[model samples]
Target chain A: MQKSTQAGFWKKNQRALAPWFFMAPGIIMFLVYVIYPIFQSIGISFYEWDGLGPKTYVGLQNYRDLLDDDSFYTSLKNNVIWLVLYLLAIPAGLAVALFLNQTVAGIRLYKSLFFFPFVISQVVVGLIFTWFYAPGFGILPHVINFFTGTPTAILADDKYATYGVIAAGLWPQTAYCMILYLTGLNNISPDQVEAARMDNAKGWSMLWHIIIPQLRPATFIALVVTVIGALRSFDLISVMTVGGPFGSTRVLSYFMYEQSLSEYGTAMGYGAAIAVVLFAIMLVFISLFIVRMLSQERNA
Target chain B: MFPKPIAQSGPWTQRAYKTLLPIALVLWLLPLIGIAITSIRPGSDLASGNYFGMPSGFAGWENYSSVFKNSNIGYYILNSFRVTIPTVIGAVGLSCLTGYALAVYKFKGNLAVFFMFVAGNFVPFQILAIPVRDLTLHMGLYNTMTGLVLFHIAFQTGFCTLFMRNFMKALPFALIESARVEGVSEFRIFWHIILPLVRPAMAALAVLIFTFIWNDYFWATVMAQSVDVRPVTAGMNELKGQYKVAWELISAAAIVAALPPVAMFFLMQKHFIAGLTLGATKG
Candidate 1:
């Protein structure tokens, strides 16, 4: 009788309760690690905590300090630069994908080889680029020397350090965008292309009008990934410059790590404040993306 | 079909296209090629300033062996596997449920919850660094493999759920409805029907997550500090410091650090691309 009662209860409430039961583990884990930490980090930004001992609430002092801090502005400016320059990967990737869209002998191997850099870790990419810019022995410096008569170490120069890092970053990012566009190109309708061709559409006009319109989904995704990749530009910076040569290479993400975790200082609150600013920037993009996804969800 | 096919173009255009292909590839991969060549070059060649020349001799064996012998890289790699494998299994397993719930069920706040995961997945790691570290410390799992694994599994669920939900959404809903009409329990349906069908997605998520966790450097530095818990990416930094200007050894070590993910990509190329380009072709 008890078993039948239990079964009856489950049978009746299953539709409402089953979803929660299914989601319990993921929801709990996401809350503990990801969702809760976001708010906690924001809360931490207001306190003067060195990661240990009692936390003293300092109100807006951390943000106030950030306002006065030159490093904050520098990091913020470099972050803007990163955001602007990183978008180049989308067009560059599209170009490569277009060029390699042809089918010929061994083209499959060529496509994979072209997409190779994205597979390696940023740490390895940083090291490789460091060697490439290694003043005397690096290939890039040698090439620059041939042209400019001086082997300028790009990473060492304040004006070029962030650009140098961004270039290394672009290598993999472009590969990523290329693959996206390649896949997008593959899914394009042959019928429409043939129709356009019959109407005497070819070359640049054809591409701008027909090909690009169909690549909207691919372009949107590429833009989103590239933007986020720019904001999360910590790994490459951490490995390559560590915000060095007068801290010219410091993005907000790297600056946060420097303030909170590095051996130089352990100002947890300050780091949290920086992170909040970065999060605020990311939230703008995230909101835009979520808004679009919500509309799609409704349509679906 | 766009841009006019090479076969339909003039012979000159065809030859030009063929020649440009290899040259473009070489130039694009020049940095990687340099590292690969440097990894095998003898120390004498680098010291003698033959940086870009043919190697004096094949010293790949010596350099790679010495990296293993003289460093904690081997141990770090083992640690990476311990952390990454469990993360792949845990994240994928958990998301299979979360994704199914979101995809198969129609309920209030469903889209809200789905968007939450999507948003959370894109947030910068710095935002979560302090509290996650604090949480791990509070649980006495800080600097331990368990701490890192738990955090990765949780964090990865966001992306996995997004992927899995979208994938499950595309499946015909009729299967679930018919099974439900027969009074098949939700759990049994998920296990016996949904699980079997989602194997391809599971494989895709597995390889993608494996590569992601393996190549993760920031979290490796943040959560796990001890020698026993440090992964290969963090260990590569230490190797860099120790081998300053020893280009050959550093090159070999970087290659070693990157080998797993590179191998994963090559082995599961199709699935990796599918996972990455999940939303590229459609909304």
Candidate 2:
């Protein structure tokens, strides 16, 4: 009788066990690659070592060195600049999306053409922008010469290099945001717009009050992606400038990479510290987003 | 409709709109158009500072052939496929089960696990870089395609899980509940009922992941060191360094490297957009 009861219990609990079984592979992989490494990196930040040799724990020394590091400040400042300027993509994207939201002959092709930049790899984007901003013979310089009569090399100039790279980033990022907003526009309820129109809402007032509200979700996502992309701005900087014109364009991501992996860099511990700091900053936003999502899940 | 379609407007306004569309598109795509033209331009034209003018001759074949001959671009493209296909399959397959579990089962840690996936997805890659590299090295997977694929699969699980769980959540629970009441096994119900329902989501994710993993530059650079394992993005960068003045060949290589994702985007545009806009519209 006890054996039969045991068999029955096993049969009943089998379904519940299935999820755990299903989850095992993905969970184990995540733990190995992502979750565990996060703590390991944080731990590595306390030790000083080149990647090759034995790690020596010198607690807080690496962080202490970062306090006096000029490059860190430069990277931090540029990151702030990137974060601020990159957000322009949201508004710029909304404008383009709104303009393209109209139905006409061959509008689909036009939309796809506009989105072409985003689909291409960023290395290609970087190359394209590098050529665009190339000195003397490049189109931008020629255009600047046409207007200003004194064409400056935009990328070679320390003041403009970071901004130039940011603009290149914006080209693709704006298109990405535009696609998101376009999708959002497709889902806007016609009833709401018609009702608003009946209430004499039109032009900027209609956009500000009605359309914008409907686009909040897209805007939120745009903001999130843009912020993350800006903070993680490495490829464009690496390809276009290599954080050049005296490393003026060095954002934290690139700085961390340069410190850890570059030919001149051997300070893995210091690089880990920078990575930890970046992670900490991102963690704040991640927590907020999670909180919002959790609340939404609860309400749902 | 919100902006009011041009079809509803006056004939003059419609004519004006029609004329404006091509001009705006041309201006918007100027850089890409320029690159496409430059890719086909003969090296002599760029040497002569004739960048803005018509090419001296179309060297499209020569440029393309040189890129293939001079570099390991073909190998890099293969590497990209190797990394991307496995990651898409592994990540998406894992998510299906996890999503089903979160959606169907009334487990205690369901929400917590779901949130963990969502949160982890958003963190910076650099945070995981050193330790991931170390772990990969320890496992003797470093600098191998397997290392890159493993990391991508694990990292992408966070995203796939979020998408899968959300999609599964919207599915009608009645099917699962009824199956359970009918003494149908949970595993069978998930496999037969819930899995079929989420095929659209899977298709969408597959296409999106294909594009993402294909275009990934950062992890490709960080994880893989040698040309044999390096993906197209990093390979292209290295090629750019080698062929400094060979603009035509460089352009050809860049175009070649970009082709797969662009093709994927065009072919799977509907599913791609559907996947991207999954949460945006509802929120």
Candidate 3:
């Protein structure tokens, strides 16, 4: 009788309850590690904690300090520079993808080889660029020598450090965008292309109107990942320069790491404040992304 | 079809395309190719300022052997596996459940929950760093492989869940509906019916996540401090500081550090691209 009662109960409520049951582990894990920490970090931003001992509420003092801090502005400006320059990968990738979108012999191997840099860790990429940019016996300096008759330590120069780092970052990011565009190109409806061609929509107009319109999904993802990549760029900077040569290379992310985690300081609250700013910048794009995904979900 | 295929163009255009193809690839991958060459160059060649010249001899074995012998990199690589394999299993396994729930069920707030995971996946890592570190410390798993594994599993679920839920949603709903008519329990339905179908996606997620976890550097530095637990990426940083100009050895180690992900990506090229480009073509 008890078993039948239980079965009956499940029959009536399983639809509603089973989802929660299934979601329990994933939801809990996400909450504990991801969602909850976002809020916790925001709350910490309003306090003055050094990652340990008692926390004292500071009521936006960290943000206030950030306003007066020149390094903070420098980092923020550098981040803007990164955001602007990093978008180059999209077009560069599309160009390459366009060039390579043919079935020549061994093209498959060529495609994978082109995407190779994205497969390696960023540390390796950073190291590679460091070697390339090294003043002595580096290929980059060798190339520059033809024009300037001298080798320049690009990473050591204040004017060039962030740009150099962005260049290193673009190596993988362009590969990433190329892969997306390659798949996007693959899925392009040949009928539409032929139709457009028949209508005399050739070359740039075809790409701008007919082709790019159909590639919207790939474009969206490329933009999203590229934006996030620009914001969270730490490994390359860390490996190449360590925000060095007068801290010209620090972005808000690296600045936060320096304030909170590095041996230089333990100002957890201050770090959280920096993170909150970065988070706020990300939230704008995140909401746009979420809204797009939601609309797609509804349509599905 | 899009670019007025070079084959349809004049023979000169086709000839030019073929000629330029390899030249473009060489220019694109120049940085990587440089490092690969550097990895094989002997220390004597580098010290003698033969950086870009043809190597006097291939010392790949010597450089790699020296890296292994003089460093804790072997232990670090082992630690990486200890953290990565479990993270792949834990994250992917948990996401299957979450994905099924979101995909198969009709529940209120499902969209909200699903979006939460998607948004959380893209959040800046710094926001989670302090709290996650503290949480691990509280659990007495700080600076241990288990702690890194646990955090990665949780963090990765965000992306994995997004991937998995979409994959599961694409599966035909009728399979589950028919099974439901026979009154098989929900768990049994998930296990016996849905699991088999999603195995391909699970494999894709497995390889992708393995590469992700293996190539992770930021979290490795944030979580593990000692060489006893440091993954190869973080350990490489220490070696970077110690051996300031052993470019050959450093390049060899970088290649070693990158080998797993590179090999995984090559072996599972199709699956890796599928996993990355799943939602890309639909729109």
Candidate 4:
């Protein structure tokens, strides 16, 4: 009798219970690793602690210190520079995609080769650029020297260091956006293009009115990723300059890592504070993307 | 079609376009081409200030072998595979379940749950880094490959779930309804029906995650310390420091470190692009 009753309960509840069961492991893992850590980091920011020490409550002192620190402002300014310059990848990517959109022999190989930088690790990209800008032996510096009668080591100078890293970063980022646009182009309605052509639309006007509108979805994604990439610009900085040349290349992400983990110091609370600020900035973008995706889901 | 299909243009225009394509590609890949050449150039060529000149002789074997002989790079790359493969399987496997639940079920808070994953996917690693490190240390998993793998799997599930959920959503809902009418259990329906259909997505997710985790540097540095567990990206930095002046060897090591993902991209070009351009069209 009890066995039958238990079976009845199972049969009745299984439909409802099934989804939760499927979702449980993923949710729990995400909560543990990704979600909960967010709040914990926020909590840690309010306390003073070296990585190895006991915590003491110190409300807003880190943020207060940030206000007075020049490095903080420098990092913030560089992040703004990164965000603005990174969006150039979208238009640049579209240009490359258009250039390679032709149906020539071996164009498939050429397209993939053009997308090669994005496939390789950024660490490798950074190293490649490092070798390219290594002063006397580096190619770019030599070219500049030929033009100006003085070799300029771009990564070593304060004014050009951030720009140099951004340029290296743009190589892979532009490739990423190019692939996105390529896929978008492949999916575009050929009839629409033919119609536009029949109307004598050619050159910049056709691209502006027809092709650009069609690539909206690709452009949206390109913007999201490029923005995120700019804000998360750590690997290139870490690999290329290690936030050096008088700390001119420091961004918020690298600054946080340097504060908490590097040999210079291990101020965990301060690092958490920096991370919280970064998170707050990212949250704004995250919310915007999520809302857009939510609307798309509803329409779908 | 947009550019009026070069075949319709004059022969001179077509010839100009054909000539321009290779030139543009060459210029675009100049840095990488430089690195590849430097990797194979004889050390004496560099020493003799012949950096840009044609190579004196092929030293690819010597430079690549010396990188292996002089450092723990081989072990580091092995550790990378150890961390990356398991992450791909775990993240993709777990997401297959979560994605199905969210996509097929009309439960309350489904949108909220889905958005949570999406938002979590985009947050900066810095926010999670300190606490995740703390958690790993407390669990005595720090400096272990398992620690890195576990964290990667958990974190990647966010992105994987977003991908899988969207993919599964595009499937025919009638299949599930018909199965329900036949009294098929939900688990069996997912296993016997949905799983087979999503193989393309699984392939796509697998290659993408493999590359992401393989190329990962931040977590490798934060979570693993000892050379035994450090993956190649972090190890590449260490190798760079060790090989400060050996541009040839450093270039070789960088190429070796980047080889697997590049090979994977070429091998799985179709699914890789499909995965990357997931929401770049239609929605």
Q: Give the docking tier of candidate 3.
A: high
**What lDDT score goes with residue A215 in model 4?**
93
In the range B1-283, model 3's lDDT, one tens digit per residue, is: 7777877888998889889989998999898889889989999998999998899998999999999999888998998889899999999999999999999998889998999999999999999998899899999999998999999999999999999999999899998999989988899999999999999899899998998898888899999998888999888888888778989988888899999999899999999999988888994
Q: In model 4, state the lDDT of residue A118.
A: 93
Which candidate's DockQ is highest? 1
For residues A1-300, write the lDDT of model 3, one tens digit per residue. Answer: 999999899889988899999999999999999999999999999999977799999998999999999999999999999999999999988988898899878889999999999999898899999989998867998788888987778999998999999999999999999999999999999999999988999989999999999989999999999999999999999999999879999999999999998876689999999999999999999999999888988887
Q: Best to worst by DockQ, what's the order?
A: 1, 4, 3, 2
- Recovery fraction of native interface contacts for candidate 3: 0.77
Per-residue lDDT over B141-227 for candidate 1, one digit per residue giving the tens place of the 0 to 100 score: 999999999999999999999999999999899999999999999999999999999998999999999988998999999988789
Model 3 chain A weakest lDDT span, ten residues long: A137-146
Task: State TM-scores per candidate.
Answer: 0.99, 0.98, 0.98, 0.99
Q: DockQ values for all predictions?
A: 0.86, 0.76, 0.83, 0.86
Compose the digit string of candidate 4's lDDT tens values, residues B153-256: 99999999999999999999999999999989999999999999999999999999999999898898888888899999999999999989789999999999
- Lowest lDDT sum, 10 consecutive residues, model 3 chain B, at B1-10
Error of 2 at A245 (Å): 1.4
Which residue runs of candidate 3 sit more than 4 Å off their true CA positions? none
lDDT of 2 by residue, B199-252 (tens): 999999998899889988889988898988999999989998998867778888
Candidate 4: residue B172 Cα off by (Å): 1.0
> Between candidates 1 and 4, which one is better according to DockQ?
1
